[model samples]
Target: MPVPCIILASPRLRKTRWPRLVVVALFFVTNCMWAKGPAPATRIPLDPLGFQPPLAQFMLAGSSMLTVDYVDSDHLLLTYSTKKLLKRLSDCPPADQDRVVDGVLLELPSGKVLARTSWRTHDHGQYLWNLGRGRFMLRIRNTLTTFAPMVNLAKGDAFAQRPFIRTERRIGGVLLSPDADLMILETMDPRPSDQVLGDQPREEDKPVQINFFRLISLNGADIDVHASGALRSRVTGRIPANSAGYIAILDDGRQHWSFDFRSYGGKIKELAAFDSTCRPSPMLVSRSEFIAFGCHLSHTPQILGAFNLRGEEMWEQTMTENYVSPSFSYAPGSGRFAMSRVLTRSSLVDSDSFSPDMFGGQEITVYQTDSGRQLLHVDAAPIARAGQNFSLSPDGLSLAVVRSDALEVYRLPELTKEERKAVQMAEASAPQIDGDPSMVLSSGNGDSTGSPERSDPSTPPAGTREQPAPAAADASSSSASVAGSTPTPPAPVADAGPKAEAQTSSTSASQQAPAEQKPSDIQGDATPDQPRRPPTLYAPGEKHGNDPAHRDDPR
Candidate 1:
């Protein structure tokens, strides 16, 4: 059954099914509005569980949080904890600790708690996975369980708990494929005497510990990872998680970079060596494309762009010094993805600079995964747990973000041709990356070489994305083009300063690839609150890019 588009919040509202004619008319009208321009976000009241709502502030370690996620487009799961102050003998009153943990299944707009139940511990968030369509897989302690609260709440206790595989080994982390067809369980145990190599003299070279990757098949039709069972005997470390259902062994080696991937129900295949300096991040790999962020280009704008699954640069864009890719949300169905930026307030100085290994973004921007068309730009209050405060629907039609006192629901609009053009052109011009694309850096080393040069938003870009023959066109062309995409050159991006390009190839694994696409850059609309980054000495086209960078670049 299709979820109703009703936004009325009255609890007494009755369910009314619209006739087919009315439904069609409503759809037509809504789309017409979207055709004109992206619609403003709809505001809805939010109900955090506790009085002192811990929605945005749950980031501190040992601090309680109110976690919220969508059960379906119209339903939400709000889990939170409450604590009581035990009578103190002395002066110390223990802080409000998360003592009683519980969850409420909320129906949006109406703000009704359909079902109420207790929840497992709030820690070890990695042990939980949203399996899509209201189902979730979670491992509490040594036991793993799967349940769907949306449908099962009416029949039994906290949805019917179906027991899955349980392992004795300590579960270190759990990851699900992008398609949610399989789960990779990383388990760890101490090094045993039998496994230890007594022949090795070096302590580091000897087996420090043992880690194993156990695969569980979530969907039988897709990759049969369980058939292979536990990967090898004892993995030296955690296996690379490929959400696109391509379980891979990445060799992020210094020179002659290469990696191997196993197709769904097929043999492992190796990719060609990458000579380019850009080392792609494997975090959000799809069957079609991957991302490369500042792999060593310090002088140029820190780049964030997509590439072919086999390691060809498709289209790229640059970001300001403060922009960080902390949270990533991709909708496999709609081919739209979102990334966030975070600015931390530090007591060390009055102004907040970008921090490493942090999760919080001042804005959450959504774009077409393939064409790189900028779809939606939203200003979000920085939350340490920014990942939880917002969610993109699986089908990619709607985006719900947690606001201070309300939930801002934004309907992702399908832009008309003119709108797509305006968005791309308004985003950024083609980026001019000079020098040899090849860069050398130590493994996990902080950067590729370049001076710390920041872009000024007030300046117009070098080029724009054109109508056709697009795949991130070179700046030399009036309209930058990417292969299998139309050219849409960039304009000055507000928050990002100077506009740049970000794009993808049309050849996605599951869907028929588009012939060509014009992509939008990571440039989201700037906000007044965000400080404009100061420009550095080394601008683009300067040789000897090896000069020390300004402190502004977020590594």
Candidate 2:
């Protein structure tokens, strides 16, 4: 009976089962790899003093920190506090603590201290101008008076005892002409207001007097253009070299006026006037043809606009809610611009919802200059609590974001082949300073010999006037007659601001971990091309109506 039983087992079925099992195994492995994710961004510590957490830590702890200014392409005039002052900030009132304890001329690309000035009483305000040929002017304010000390980096002296200009009026602003030969200072007069009652004057009745000073030589031969006006805020930039004029945006609360200053005699002529619809803040003027400004209609949402030099509207876009302060950076190499803002999303609904918190993050958007087309958008987890600063590299190849603890640099998108060639040519033609290869020679105070060795026709020098390019001839032509045309009202465009969203869902988890994690937490063997997990834009129950499509691929 056993022999009679027929056995039936198919060899073909066994062969097919092995292949199916292999395919299932491959699918599981691929998904697991994707879930692990790619490595996070690389963070470079900006600390030169090896201060454990960075300078921003002491700054946030109520320590008065000095303002940092760029001296040249290779150097930054940085101010720091002594250990004593930093320690007192925690216990003593900020008014009692001395803010300006140390000064150091910092070298760029490599965060090295090139020179250190002798410690002196400073009022936490300083300005720097590169005087070409290894000479730089450092203006430091102590108490009510300001002193301009000259420093020669090649001579190894941090400060020269002789001051260039000593003034009683607080230096409200400093503008260097394109050639760096002429210096203009908007100084605020400290005289008592005529509206004073007895001794103390009412805040609203205080006189707002501004005196314009034009310095011809570094030795302080100055001309005072006694044009007294109340300027609440001012933005100035050099006109194109061919035109030899300066453009400025002056806000006096009631109106925002644009002025053109003739370089020959420091005469200012009003160009255009704008009524206060939104508080307008000028961002940057490029090639004397394009200008950018950020206006705050209210606290939550913002408006960013571009205008021709004639003050004609080019393009306008509306920013998202929860933006702390919008900032813009332009790249001359590619004629592109980037805007950044600190964004927050909250689970709790209240009047103070926009307050920056651990659930906050940062977003950056890039746009083309000609078409206003958005090029790229990137978002990252919260770097700092409230204040976040970012800057584009001179070459426009990298963008650096400074958080409270670390400096996060991301490589920018690749430029077109033509743009790359243009940048290389511009770099080659730029004037090279003697000691520092990175420092380019700028136009020195009325000295024709101090100009760069070879100037690029395509690129404009720093602080130089920029003429409209041939490609923009039509726009400039139309803008030239815009003075008679009424300014167009700011039109808000929906879903136009930065579109990057956060990827993490748990606020507590992100807060507990460092701003940047080790590569092991990400995929160990993943390539840079591998995509990371997209950050969550909203918290558990939060919603944003204006949020653009979430961009996960940074490339």
lDDT of 2 by residue, 1-555 (tens): 011111243334355656866766766686675544322244545465432332533322212243233444445454444554332334332232243455666565666666676454433333344443234455554122222222444455655433344454445344443334434343433434232222543222222111222223333321112111111111111122212333333333433433232222233233344333432333333433344344444423356565444445556676655543343455655656667664546323232222333235567666655445565455533232222245454445555554444445555556777656644543353322222100111111111111244232223243333221111001112111111122222111111112113313322232222112111110011123532211110011111111111111000
lDDT of 1 by residue, 304-353 (tens): 66544444454566555454224556665555667665544431211133
> Best-fitting candidate, measured by TM-score?
1
lDDT, candidate 1, equals 0.40
What are the per-model numbers of colliding residue pairs?
Answer: 37, 14
> How large an RMSD does model 1 have?
20.0
- In order, candidate lDDTs are 0.40, 0.35
Query: Lowest-scoring 10 consecutive residues by lDDT in candidate 1?
Result: 437-446
User: Candidate 2's C-alpha lDDT?
Assistant: 0.35
Q: Give the clash count for model 2.
A: 14
